[model samples]
Target: MTVETIDTVVVGGGQAGIAMSEHLTSHAIPHIVLERHRIAERWRSERWDSLVANGPAWHDRFPGLKFDDLDPDAFAPKERVADYFVQYAEKIGAPVRTGVEVNSVTRLDGRPGFRVETSRGVIEARNIVAATGPFQKPVIPQIVPEDADIFQIHSNRYRNPEQLPEGAVLVVGAGASGAQIGAELMRTGRRVYLAAGPHDRPPRSYRGRDFCWWLGVLGKWDLAAPAPGTEHVSIAVSGANGGETVDFRALAREGLTLVGRAERYANGILYFGAGLVQSIRHGDANYLSVLDEADAYIARNGLDLPEEPEARDFGSEPECLTAPIRALDLADAGITSIIWATGYALDYSWLDVDAFDEMGRPAHQRGKSTEPGVYFLGLPWQSRRGSSFIWGVWHDARHVADSIATQRSYLEYHAQAEARSA
Candidate 1:
């Protein structure tokens, strides 16, 4: 087999890969990006037509470019974002080899650093950037009963609610994806049931003022600070900081029956925590009192300045309490479909790196992995609010690229001296 050598080989060509490629090219670094398919194929193939970004356009912009001629608050359609990425690749002249499937990477003991096994050929590079995104694989919860006759699908596979069954639909997670799908189904007049999970629910605005504005004013998105202790404070949860809250909650108020965490589904019956439905109602009630206290805190101390972090927004809370039941009970309520809004998992089995922790994530400091030259970008909670975000990947990418460049230059200088002595 012929062995080709390069300074670096970047794996995966999604948003993170593109950003890394751009930085490498700008520095005139020798690197090639390997993609499994045509660029942005996931975005083009997976997203729905009416889907807009849960976050605003400003938060979605990639490195060194802004999304102009678009509303900042509006979530750009998937197609638009995909087009932007395409244009970005073209503009930067990112060296991308599409339709190449990388099989594995093996560390070379001497000379050519590492060898990448791919369908096309073997590539030898001193460094490798695994830009494969975190959400490459879909996660279907184990709690989903195998014996259940009802159709079950992961959120990644879900394009729209058209494929759902006729009767009422039950959605399992309440994260951004879960909430969005739940709200959409409800809007289509389907009887939607959402299984609320441990998640933050932020609102579109705070007291009529856009929350995005506050995020900017607070300089929360700035990349200057190396590390902030309270970075994951209340802002960690979507609505815990007293934002407008999610569209899912609004849907719940509309008519969607919010359900408890599903323990399991078997024999067409969905089992949940005993009295969980009532417990949730009780929590909602207490949350209402908490909300009142929060509102009082906010009112006492204007939005401009508060003595301490604000309380969670619950409006006034629900007055009613109810008991949780099994999925078989759904038959009585006429619920039919099930949307597993459960979140995704990170899959790195394809990569031959030994730097991963028990959770399958790379052992890294900021962006530097335990492996000397290997680095990670676009990981969730990589740095701060910007870590896993599409726009935020650049901060980590830039830092990693700089570190690599410095190390590469040092290696080059030492090699030159050895050559002269020889």
Candidate 2:
């Protein structure tokens, strides 16, 4: 295959890739962004029909543009979000080639660049940024056998409740997606059972300010990743219902049976972990801790923010936590569907570089890999807690662009030195 040469090759067209492209353009770098689908395709296709942006419009966007038509506190619908990125790319003239899929990234042996193999063609780039974003592959736990009679779909493909079979649903994994979906199904008169798991609950709003604002002002956004395993764990906050706090205890009161984590399937029966109460308590603690931190910040700064009573009240743990369900028979409960919102699995199988950890995660320092001219973007906790969020991606992208520019200058300097020696 003929190789198309470029200075940089960005591997995604989503928020991360586009953001990286914008920075590279500003640096006067010659690069191309290859996307498997359209820009911000996940927001348009992978998400559920009712999904909205995680943060309010004013806060979660690039510096060049404000979501002009949207209110400061309002969360933009997913369609608008996709449109916003598309507009941003156009405004900055991002060179994004849609429908181009990158198959692998390997070094240009005995050289200082990379050979990116893609579906459309080959691209030999001096530098590469793997801006593939966090949600690469759906992670469906093997709790249920493939032959199980119940219908199953990952949250990536779930559009709405009406798409499922005419029966109750068992939603597995209670993160943002699962909680929002479970609540939606329950509202539509469908009997729902949610398999609760360890998730952080950040209030939708605290003292008249969005949770993101609190995180930013308190420097939580700048903080590094937490525990190793919890780095990828999603927060249980939803933009639906005009920004709602995902409280499992409240959902239980609304008739949704909250169960523990789905463990394994044996003898045609599903077993659950016995830490239902602990999981709920963990979310409650996180919720309270956030409120407490916000209150502390207000007091320290002497801000006039009023106390939010409801934000602090997460409700009492439901009985399911105390008397956890040991087993579940899908047929007995009339449940014919299972939605797996169990987060994503990191898939960098196409990376032909020694720049990953034992956990299969990219081993990079602030987006720069140990392997020269190779970088990773849109990763969880890449630089800060907000690294993966849309509002924060541009910061990481800028850093990656700076790294690329610096390396390019170094290479240019070395080439000049070699020419002088000759």
Which parts of model 2 have CA positions greater than 4 angstroms off? none
**Candidate with best TM-score:** 2
TM-score of each: 0.83, 0.96
Model 2 lDDT vs. the true structure? Answer: 0.88
Q: Number of clashes in every candidate structure? A: 8, 0
Candidate 2 lDDT, 1-422, residue by residue in tens: 56799999998999999999989988899999999999999999999999988888888888899999998888899999999999999999999999998899888878778888898988999888888889999989888877888799999999998899999999998888899999999999999999987889888887889988888898899988786677555688888988877778888988899988899888768888888888888887888888898898899989998777866655676677667797988788898999999999778889898888877778899999877788999988899989999978999999999988888788889989999999
For candidate 1, write residues 112-173 as lDDT tens digits: 46788988999988888888876777777787565565677777677887877788888877
Enumerate residue pairs that collide in model 1: 168-336, 201-239, 202-238, 202-239, 202-245, 203-244, 203-245, 270-327
Best candidate, lDDT: 2
Per-residue lDDT, model 1, residue 351, is 70
